[model samples]
Target: MARMKKNFITSLFDTKGKSQDTEEGLTKIISDFFSSIFSSSNPSELDILKASKGIKSRMTGIMSEALGSQYSAEEVKDAIFGLSPTKAPGPDGFHAIFFQKAWG
Candidate 1:
Protein backbone atom coordinates (compact mmCIF):
# COMPACT_ATOMS: atom_id res chain seq x y z
CA MET A 1 0.00 0.00 0.00
CA ALA A 2 1.30 3.43 -0.96
CA ARG A 3 1.44 5.94 1.83
CA MET A 4 -0.48 9.16 1.24
CA LYS A 5 1.30 12.41 1.88
CA LYS A 6 -0.61 15.17 3.56
CA ASN A 7 -0.52 18.61 1.91
CA PHE A 8 1.80 21.16 3.50
CA ILE A 9 -1.08 23.16 4.90
CA THR A 10 -2.81 20.08 6.18
CA SER A 11 0.34 19.00 7.98
CA LEU A 12 0.85 22.46 9.38
CA PHE A 13 -2.62 22.65 10.93
CA ASP A 14 -2.65 19.02 11.88
CA THR A 15 -2.47 19.70 15.62
CA LYS A 16 -4.22 16.42 15.99
CA GLY A 17 -0.77 14.73 16.30
CA LYS A 18 2.52 16.21 15.12
CA SER A 19 5.56 18.17 16.29
CA GLN A 20 6.48 20.77 13.69
CA ASP A 21 8.30 24.00 14.30
CA THR A 22 6.41 27.25 13.89
CA GLU A 23 8.58 28.67 11.13
CA GLU A 24 8.81 25.46 9.11
CA GLY A 25 5.10 24.83 9.40
CA LEU A 26 4.22 28.38 8.49
CA THR A 27 6.62 28.49 5.54
CA LYS A 28 5.19 25.27 4.10
CA ILE A 29 1.67 26.55 4.65
CA ILE A 30 2.39 29.77 2.81
CA SER A 31 4.28 28.10 -0.02
CA ASP A 32 1.54 25.53 -0.52
CA PHE A 33 -1.15 28.18 -0.64
CA PHE A 34 0.61 30.26 -3.27
CA SER A 35 1.63 27.21 -5.28
CA SER A 36 -1.95 26.01 -5.34
CA ILE A 37 -3.20 29.36 -6.57
CA PHE A 38 -0.54 29.72 -9.27
CA SER A 39 -1.06 26.17 -10.44
CA SER A 40 -4.84 26.31 -10.42
CA SER A 41 -5.42 27.36 -14.04
CA ASN A 42 -2.60 27.10 -16.53
CA PRO A 43 -2.66 30.01 -19.00
CA SER A 44 -1.43 30.12 -22.60
CA GLU A 45 1.97 31.08 -23.92
CA LEU A 46 1.04 34.63 -24.87
CA ASP A 47 -1.00 35.19 -21.73
CA ILE A 48 1.82 33.78 -19.66
CA LEU A 49 4.31 35.90 -21.57
CA LYS A 50 2.22 39.00 -20.91
CA ALA A 51 1.97 38.08 -17.23
CA SER A 52 5.67 37.24 -17.08
CA LYS A 53 6.45 40.68 -18.41
CA GLY A 54 4.70 42.11 -15.36
CA ILE A 55 6.54 39.75 -13.04
CA LYS A 56 9.90 40.52 -14.63
CA SER A 57 9.21 44.20 -14.20
CA ARG A 58 8.65 43.62 -10.51
CA MET A 59 11.74 41.41 -10.29
CA THR A 60 13.83 44.13 -11.88
CA GLY A 61 12.56 46.54 -9.26
CA ILE A 62 13.56 44.12 -6.52
CA MET A 63 16.95 43.61 -8.11
CA SER A 64 17.44 47.34 -8.42
CA GLU A 65 16.45 47.79 -4.77
CA ALA A 66 18.99 45.22 -3.62
CA LEU A 67 21.74 46.37 -5.98
CA GLY A 68 20.96 50.06 -5.78
CA SER A 69 20.65 50.48 -9.55
CA GLN A 70 17.93 50.30 -12.13
CA TYR A 71 18.19 47.84 -14.99
CA SER A 72 18.81 49.33 -18.43
CA ALA A 73 15.92 49.23 -20.88
CA GLU A 74 17.79 46.61 -22.90
CA GLU A 75 18.42 44.54 -19.80
CA VAL A 76 14.73 44.65 -18.98
CA LYS A 77 13.86 43.62 -22.51
CA ASP A 78 16.33 40.74 -22.39
CA ALA A 79 15.00 39.58 -19.05
CA ILE A 80 11.44 39.60 -20.31
CA PHE A 81 12.40 37.82 -23.51
CA GLY A 82 14.30 35.18 -21.57
CA LEU A 83 11.12 34.02 -19.89
CA SER A 84 9.52 30.95 -21.54
CA PRO A 85 5.79 30.38 -22.04
CA THR A 86 3.44 28.02 -20.25
CA LYS A 87 1.21 25.38 -21.89
CA ALA A 88 -1.88 26.29 -23.95
CA PRO A 89 -4.72 27.76 -21.94
CA GLY A 90 -7.80 25.53 -21.85
CA PRO A 91 -11.08 26.16 -23.73
CA ASP A 92 -13.09 28.24 -21.29
CA GLY A 93 -11.83 31.79 -20.79
CA PHE A 94 -8.80 31.04 -22.95
CA HIS A 95 -7.43 34.10 -24.74
CA ALA A 96 -4.30 34.45 -26.82
CA ILE A 97 -3.12 36.64 -29.67
CA PHE A 98 -2.06 33.64 -31.71
CA PHE A 99 -5.42 31.92 -31.29
CA GLN A 100 -7.36 35.03 -32.18
CA LYS A 101 -5.21 35.92 -35.13
CA ALA A 102 -5.23 32.35 -36.39
CA TRP A 103 -8.98 31.87 -36.06
CA GLY A 104 -10.00 35.31 -37.20
Candidate 2:
Protein backbone atom coordinates (compact mmCIF):
# COMPACT_ATOMS: atom_id res chain seq x y z
CA MET A 1 0.00 0.00 0.00
CA ALA A 2 2.80 2.43 0.86
CA ARG A 3 4.60 1.80 -2.37
CA MET A 4 1.38 2.19 -4.32
CA LYS A 5 0.71 5.57 -2.70
CA LYS A 6 4.23 6.75 -3.44
CA ASN A 7 3.91 5.70 -7.07
CA PHE A 8 0.61 7.50 -7.40
CA ILE A 9 2.03 10.73 -6.00
CA THR A 10 5.07 10.50 -8.23
CA SER A 11 2.90 9.96 -11.27
CA LEU A 12 0.75 12.93 -10.34
CA PHE A 13 3.82 15.14 -9.98
CA ASP A 14 5.14 13.96 -13.32
CA THR A 15 1.86 14.81 -15.01
CA LYS A 16 1.74 18.23 -13.42
CA GLY A 17 5.32 18.95 -14.41
CA LYS A 18 4.63 17.95 -18.01
CA SER A 19 1.60 20.19 -18.18
CA GLN A 20 3.55 23.12 -16.80
CA ASP A 21 6.27 22.63 -19.35
CA THR A 22 3.74 22.49 -22.15
CA GLU A 23 2.13 25.70 -20.99
CA GLU A 24 5.46 27.46 -20.92
CA GLY A 25 6.28 26.24 -24.38
CA LEU A 26 2.97 27.50 -25.69
CA THR A 27 3.55 30.90 -24.14
CA LYS A 28 6.90 31.15 -25.81
CA ILE A 29 5.34 30.24 -29.15
CA ILE A 30 2.77 32.95 -28.69
CA SER A 31 5.48 35.50 -27.97
CA ASP A 32 7.46 34.42 -30.98
CA PHE A 33 4.42 34.68 -33.19
CA PHE A 34 3.82 38.24 -32.08
CA SER A 35 7.43 39.11 -32.65
CA SER A 36 7.23 37.83 -36.21
CA ILE A 37 4.10 39.81 -36.94
CA PHE A 38 5.81 43.04 -35.97
CA SER A 39 9.28 42.25 -37.23
CA SER A 40 9.03 44.31 -40.40
CA SER A 41 7.28 47.58 -41.05
CA ASN A 42 5.10 47.12 -37.98
CA PRO A 43 5.65 48.36 -34.48
CA SER A 44 6.02 46.26 -31.39
CA GLU A 45 3.39 45.48 -28.77
CA LEU A 46 4.28 48.61 -26.84
CA ASP A 47 3.71 50.76 -29.89
CA ILE A 48 0.38 49.16 -30.69
CA LEU A 49 -0.86 49.57 -27.15
CA LYS A 50 0.30 53.17 -27.14
CA ALA A 51 -1.72 53.93 -30.25
CA SER A 52 -4.86 52.26 -29.00
CA LYS A 53 -6.58 55.48 -27.99
CA GLY A 54 -6.89 57.44 -31.19
CA ILE A 55 -8.65 57.14 -34.53
CA LYS A 56 -5.46 58.08 -36.35
CA SER A 57 -3.07 55.63 -34.76
CA ARG A 58 -0.23 53.96 -36.66
CA MET A 59 -2.28 50.92 -37.57
CA THR A 60 -5.15 53.08 -38.71
CA GLY A 61 -2.79 55.21 -40.72
CA ILE A 62 -1.47 52.13 -42.48
CA MET A 63 -4.96 50.88 -43.21
CA SER A 64 -6.08 54.22 -44.51
CA GLU A 65 -3.12 54.52 -46.82
CA ALA A 66 -3.34 51.01 -48.26
CA LEU A 67 -6.69 49.45 -47.53
CA GLY A 68 -8.59 52.79 -47.85
CA SER A 69 -9.70 55.48 -45.45
CA GLN A 70 -12.63 53.52 -44.06
CA TYR A 71 -10.55 50.46 -43.33
CA SER A 72 -10.23 49.41 -39.71
CA ALA A 73 -7.68 47.12 -38.08
CA GLU A 74 -10.39 44.69 -37.11
CA GLU A 75 -11.50 44.49 -40.72
CA VAL A 76 -7.96 44.12 -41.94
CA LYS A 77 -7.31 41.36 -39.46
CA ASP A 78 -10.47 39.57 -40.46
CA ALA A 79 -9.61 39.90 -44.12
CA ILE A 80 -6.15 38.52 -43.55
CA PHE A 81 -7.14 35.63 -41.33
CA GLY A 82 -10.63 34.93 -42.67
CA LEU A 83 -12.00 34.99 -39.17
CA SER A 84 -13.90 37.32 -36.86
CA PRO A 85 -12.12 39.96 -34.78
CA THR A 86 -12.45 37.83 -31.67
CA LYS A 87 -10.57 34.98 -33.27
CA ALA A 88 -7.22 36.66 -32.70
CA PRO A 89 -6.69 36.84 -28.99
CA GLY A 90 -4.52 39.81 -28.11
CA PRO A 91 -1.09 39.39 -26.60
CA ASP A 92 -0.70 39.47 -22.80
CA GLY A 93 -4.47 39.20 -22.37
CA PHE A 94 -5.03 42.75 -23.59
CA HIS A 95 -6.09 44.10 -26.96
CA ALA A 96 -3.82 46.47 -28.79
CA ILE A 97 -6.03 48.91 -30.57
CA PHE A 98 -4.72 49.18 -34.11
CA PHE A 99 -5.06 52.05 -36.51
CA GLN A 100 -4.58 50.91 -40.07
CA LYS A 101 -1.50 52.01 -41.96
CA ALA A 102 0.83 50.24 -44.36
CA TRP A 103 4.27 50.26 -42.90
CA GLY A 104 4.56 47.11 -44.93
Candidate 3:
Protein backbone atom coordinates (compact mmCIF):
# COMPACT_ATOMS: atom_id res chain seq x y z
CA MET A 1 0.00 0.00 0.00
CA ALA A 2 1.22 3.51 -0.87
CA ARG A 3 1.45 6.12 1.92
CA MET A 4 -0.21 9.51 1.43
CA LYS A 5 2.01 12.58 1.00
CA LYS A 6 2.35 14.88 4.09
CA ASN A 7 1.89 18.62 3.58
CA PHE A 8 4.10 20.98 5.62
CA ILE A 9 3.11 24.51 6.67
CA THR A 10 5.58 27.01 5.14
CA SER A 11 4.95 30.20 7.06
CA LEU A 12 5.01 31.22 10.77
CA PHE A 13 4.61 34.36 12.88
CA ASP A 14 7.76 35.50 14.77
CA THR A 15 7.93 37.06 18.27
CA LYS A 16 7.75 40.54 16.74
CA GLY A 17 4.43 39.44 15.10
CA LYS A 18 6.15 39.53 11.70
CA SER A 19 5.49 36.81 9.11
CA GLN A 20 8.38 34.35 8.57
CA ASP A 21 8.63 32.52 5.20
CA THR A 22 11.99 30.67 5.52
CA GLU A 23 12.62 27.51 7.62
CA GLU A 24 15.44 29.21 9.59
CA GLY A 25 13.16 32.12 10.47
CA LEU A 26 10.46 29.72 11.69
CA THR A 27 13.01 27.77 13.79
CA LYS A 28 14.41 31.01 15.27
CA ILE A 29 10.87 32.18 16.12
CA ILE A 30 10.04 28.86 17.83
CA SER A 31 13.33 28.89 19.77
CA ASP A 32 12.84 32.49 20.90
CA PHE A 33 9.22 31.75 21.95
CA PHE A 34 10.21 28.71 24.05
CA SER A 35 13.22 30.52 25.60
CA SER A 36 10.94 33.38 26.59
CA ILE A 37 8.36 31.00 28.16
CA PHE A 38 10.95 28.80 29.92
CA SER A 39 13.49 31.36 31.25
CA SER A 40 17.13 30.15 31.65
CA SER A 41 17.37 30.98 35.39
CA ASN A 42 17.29 27.67 37.34
CA PRO A 43 17.52 26.37 40.91
CA SER A 44 20.79 27.29 42.68
CA GLU A 45 23.52 24.72 43.50
CA LEU A 46 22.58 24.63 47.22
CA ASP A 47 18.90 24.01 46.42
CA ILE A 48 19.82 21.11 44.06
CA LEU A 49 22.14 19.48 46.62
CA LYS A 50 19.50 19.97 49.34
CA ALA A 51 16.87 18.11 47.23
CA SER A 52 19.23 15.23 46.37
CA LYS A 53 20.24 14.77 50.06
CA GLY A 54 16.66 13.68 51.04
CA ILE A 55 16.28 11.18 48.12
CA LYS A 56 17.46 7.57 48.48
CA SER A 57 20.84 6.95 46.82
CA ARG A 58 20.27 3.61 45.02
CA MET A 59 23.01 3.65 42.37
CA THR A 60 25.63 1.88 44.53
CA GLY A 61 23.12 -0.77 45.74
CA ILE A 62 21.61 -1.26 42.25
CA MET A 63 25.11 -1.67 40.73
CA SER A 64 26.03 -4.29 43.37
CA GLU A 65 22.67 -6.09 42.87
CA ALA A 66 23.13 -6.14 39.10
CA LEU A 67 26.67 -7.54 39.48
CA GLY A 68 25.45 -10.24 41.93
CA SER A 69 22.35 -11.25 39.91
CA GLN A 70 22.56 -14.25 37.57
CA TYR A 71 21.21 -13.91 33.98
CA SER A 72 18.84 -16.64 32.75
CA ALA A 73 18.14 -17.26 29.05
CA GLU A 74 14.82 -18.91 30.00
CA GLU A 75 13.57 -15.62 31.56
CA VAL A 76 14.38 -13.71 28.35
CA LYS A 77 12.70 -16.42 26.22
CA ASP A 78 9.60 -16.35 28.42
CA ALA A 79 9.36 -12.53 28.17
CA ILE A 80 9.65 -12.55 24.37
CA PHE A 81 7.09 -15.33 23.97
CA GLY A 82 4.70 -13.57 26.38
CA LEU A 83 4.23 -10.57 23.99
CA SER A 84 0.76 -10.20 22.36
CA PRO A 85 0.71 -11.78 18.89
CA THR A 86 -2.39 -9.69 17.92
CA LYS A 87 -0.53 -6.37 18.34
CA ALA A 88 0.65 -4.58 15.15
CA PRO A 89 4.30 -4.43 14.14
CA GLY A 90 6.31 -1.50 15.58
CA PRO A 91 7.90 1.32 13.52
CA ASP A 92 10.75 -1.08 12.55
CA GLY A 93 7.99 -3.19 10.92
CA PHE A 94 8.79 -6.13 13.18
CA HIS A 95 5.89 -7.84 14.95
CA ALA A 96 5.99 -9.75 18.24
CA ILE A 97 5.44 -12.94 16.18
CA PHE A 98 8.95 -12.51 14.77
CA PHE A 99 10.55 -12.52 18.24
CA GLN A 100 8.12 -15.23 19.43
CA LYS A 101 9.28 -17.58 16.66
CA ALA A 102 12.95 -16.50 16.93
CA TRP A 103 12.93 -17.14 20.70
CA GLY A 104 11.67 -20.71 20.14
Candidate 4:
Protein backbone atom coordinates (compact mmCIF):
# COMPACT_ATOMS: atom_id res chain seq x y z
CA MET A 1 0.00 0.00 0.00
CA ALA A 2 1.30 3.49 -0.92
CA ARG A 3 1.29 6.18 1.77
CA MET A 4 -0.33 9.56 1.03
CA LYS A 5 2.16 12.40 0.67
CA LYS A 6 1.78 15.38 3.02
CA ASN A 7 1.78 18.93 1.62
CA PHE A 8 4.56 21.19 2.92
CA ILE A 9 4.40 24.94 3.69
CA THR A 10 6.53 26.31 0.83
CA SER A 11 5.40 29.90 1.07
CA LEU A 12 8.22 32.36 1.84
CA PHE A 13 8.62 36.12 2.26
CA ASP A 14 11.01 38.08 0.07
CA THR A 15 13.15 41.08 1.11
CA LYS A 16 10.61 43.82 0.27
CA GLY A 17 7.71 42.25 2.23
CA LYS A 18 6.82 40.26 -0.88
CA SER A 19 5.33 36.77 -0.58
CA GLN A 20 6.70 33.90 -2.67
CA ASP A 21 4.70 30.74 -3.49
CA THR A 22 6.11 29.35 -6.73
CA GLU A 23 9.11 27.00 -6.51
CA GLU A 24 11.30 29.24 -8.73
CA GLY A 25 10.44 32.35 -6.72
CA LEU A 26 11.19 30.62 -3.44
CA THR A 27 14.51 29.28 -4.80
CA LYS A 28 15.50 32.72 -6.20
CA ILE A 29 14.69 34.45 -2.90
CA ILE A 30 16.76 31.91 -0.96
CA SER A 31 19.68 32.14 -3.42
CA ASP A 32 19.63 35.95 -3.33
CA PHE A 33 19.49 36.08 0.48
CA PHE A 34 22.35 33.61 1.00
CA SER A 35 24.41 35.09 -1.89
CA SER A 36 24.16 38.57 -0.38
CA ILE A 37 25.20 37.28 3.06
CA PHE A 38 28.16 35.27 1.65
CA SER A 39 29.23 38.05 -0.79
CA SER A 40 29.56 40.57 2.06
CA SER A 41 33.18 41.43 2.93
CA ASN A 42 34.65 39.87 6.06
CA PRO A 43 36.72 42.14 8.33
CA SER A 44 37.19 39.53 11.06
CA GLU A 45 39.75 37.37 9.22
CA LEU A 46 42.44 38.05 11.85
CA ASP A 47 40.16 37.05 14.74
CA ILE A 48 38.96 33.94 12.90
CA LEU A 49 42.51 32.87 12.01
CA LYS A 50 43.67 33.25 15.62
CA ALA A 51 40.71 31.10 16.77
CA SER A 52 41.64 28.31 14.28
CA LYS A 53 44.87 27.38 16.07
CA GLY A 54 43.11 26.14 19.24
CA ILE A 55 40.47 24.09 17.36
CA LYS A 56 43.01 22.86 14.78
CA SER A 57 45.38 21.54 17.49
CA ARG A 58 42.53 19.78 19.31
CA MET A 59 41.21 18.17 16.08
CA THR A 60 44.72 17.11 15.07
CA GLY A 61 45.22 15.44 18.48
CA ILE A 62 41.98 13.48 18.10
CA MET A 63 42.82 12.42 14.53
CA SER A 64 46.32 11.35 15.58
CA GLU A 65 44.91 8.97 18.21
CA ALA A 66 42.58 7.31 15.68
CA LEU A 67 45.16 7.25 12.87
CA GLY A 68 47.77 5.61 15.13
CA SER A 69 45.58 2.52 15.63
CA GLN A 70 46.16 -0.47 13.27
CA TYR A 71 43.15 -2.21 11.74
CA SER A 72 42.99 -5.83 10.54
CA ALA A 73 41.84 -6.70 6.99
CA GLU A 74 38.87 -8.61 8.47
CA GLU A 75 37.79 -5.49 10.35
CA VAL A 76 37.74 -3.46 7.10
CA LYS A 77 35.80 -6.22 5.32
CA ASP A 78 33.26 -6.47 8.15
CA ALA A 79 32.69 -2.71 8.16
CA ILE A 80 31.94 -2.50 4.41
CA PHE A 81 29.75 -5.65 4.40
CA GLY A 82 27.64 -4.20 7.25
CA LEU A 83 26.08 -1.59 4.89
CA SER A 84 22.71 -2.49 3.30
CA PRO A 85 22.92 -3.09 -0.46
CA THR A 86 19.74 -1.08 -1.13
CA LYS A 87 20.99 2.06 0.64
CA ALA A 88 21.20 5.13 -1.62
CA PRO A 89 24.51 6.35 -2.97
CA GLY A 90 25.96 9.71 -1.84
CA PRO A 91 26.22 12.84 -4.03
CA ASP A 92 29.25 11.34 -5.85
CA GLY A 93 26.90 8.72 -7.34
CA PHE A 94 28.91 5.75 -6.04
CA HIS A 95 26.99 3.32 -3.83
CA ALA A 96 28.79 1.98 -0.74
CA ILE A 97 27.67 -1.57 -1.58
CA PHE A 98 29.82 -1.35 -4.71
CA PHE A 99 32.90 -1.40 -2.50
CA GLN A 100 31.60 -4.40 -0.58
CA LYS A 101 31.15 -6.39 -3.84
CA ALA A 102 34.54 -5.22 -5.09
CA TRP A 103 36.22 -6.66 -1.98
CA GLY A 104 35.25 -10.22 -3.08
| Candidate 1 lDDT by residue in tens digits, 1-104 | 23444433333553344545588776776687688877847557887677767553445667668788666867755554444434455475454433444442
Candidate 3 ranges beyond 4 A from true positions: 1-12, 35-39, 42-44, 51-70
TM-score of each: 0.24, 0.20, 0.53, 0.44
Q: What's the residue-level lDDT of 56 in candidate 3? A: 90
Q: By lDDT, highest first, what's the ranking?
A: 3, 4, 1, 2
CA deviation > 4 Å runs, candidate 1: 1-21, 46-104
Worst 10 residues of 3 by lDDT: 1-10
Residues 1-104, candidate 2: write the lDDT tens digits.
98888764221123235422465565665576687786877548888677775755456666667865577876766664553434445665532233123324
Please give the distance, in angstroms, between residue 82's alpha carbon in candidate 1 and its true position after superposition.
34
**Cα-based lDDT for every prediction:** 0.57, 0.53, 0.80, 0.80
**At residue 63, what lDDT does model 2 achieve?**
62
> Mind giving the per-residue lDDT tens digits that candidate 3 earns over 1-102?
123334565789876788998989988988888987877477588877998899996679789998789979997787778889759887889998988876
Window of ten residues with lowest summed lDDT in model 2: 94-103
Using alpha carbons, what is the TM-score of model 2?
A: 0.20
Worst 10 residues of 4 by lDDT: 1-10
Q: Rank the candidates by TM-score, best first.
A: 3, 4, 1, 2
Candidate 2 global lDDT: 0.53
lDDT of 1 at 19: 47
